[model samples]
Target: MKKVILGLSALCMVAFTSCKEDASSKINSENVAAAAERDATSGDFPTITFEETEHDFGTIVNGTPVETKFKYKNTGNSPLVVSNIKSTCGCTVPSDWNREPLAPGESAEFTVKFNGKGKGAVTKSITLTTNTEKGSEVVKIKSFVEADPNAPAKTPAKPVIKQVQ
Candidate 1:
């Protein structure tokens, strides 16, 4: 589906981009898998790597639904387990995840669908519970929703005039 392709594209981008400092900072599938083997021989070491932690939905029409994907990979040696994903509130909801134990170098994505029913600047966060060192990670989504132009407007009623015969 579209979501699958988008996730794959994100994975590819992360694999291709250059890291700024540590090798972990720039995780590629090739190195991640290699490290996984080393970890298996040594001990269990699970790490989570997100291609991008934040997503901006920009401007959206009021009462409309907007969405985006937060892509991640297990760069650790052990299988990465995502226990749960909690959203800040109902306005933003996580639609899907791979669910199974994510093997090292294997990629997955969490898709969030946001309802822009309230007209104003909106920000939401998703808390991911994983078996990583920190045990949790936060991903953010933001947007500015414009008023719905097609919404019906209220009009004042005309005053009744009294006639005297």
Candidate 2:
């Protein structure tokens, strides 16, 4: 029995040794140089400087759509790449923006449309995913939606009463 156990252990050791790989074999000179270059320029990150981070549409009628332009500039040493723009809700839509990489000191603008569907003091945010130092940035839109005079009046819900058993 001890001989059988020793033979099994030896077999397992051989299998593991054969499966082992040399970590240095996967790395090459080109890969090392690329990694070094990336590390050396890691501090050079693009920055987004918005002319106005927030915009207020003032008083607007409910159900009316409104739009505004948000201007920005690249104020860093690296190029700025805005990969995506997302809104907090479907009622707000963003469009008409530059899709190319913005060089340092270049300016760009995007349009944001808000479908005035909320009540008073409505606020929404649009997030931009970029290659900036912070990776992402946020802009806000606000408005006071007044009730439309022509809108149909909402009927009050009827109360339900439950009888005691």
In candidate 2 the C-alpha lDDT for residue 139 amounts to 99
Give a tens-digit lDDT track for model 2, residues 22-106.
Answer: 9888889998999999999999999899999999999999999999999999999999999899899999999988989999999
Provide the lowest-lDDT 10-residue window in model 1.
Answer: 18-27
Clashing pairs in 1: none
Top lDDT: which candidate number? 2
lDDT per residue for candidate 1 within 70-120, as digits (tens), equals 999999988999989989899889968877999999999989999886668
lDDT per model vs. reference: 0.88, 0.96
User: Per-candidate RMSD vs. true structure?
Assistant: 21.6, 3.1
Name the lDDT of candidate 2: 0.96
Clashes of each: 0, 0
Candidate 2 C-alpha RMSD relative to the actual structure: 3.1
Candidate 1, residue 86: how far the Cα is off, in Å: 1.4
Give the clash total for candidate 1. Answer: 0
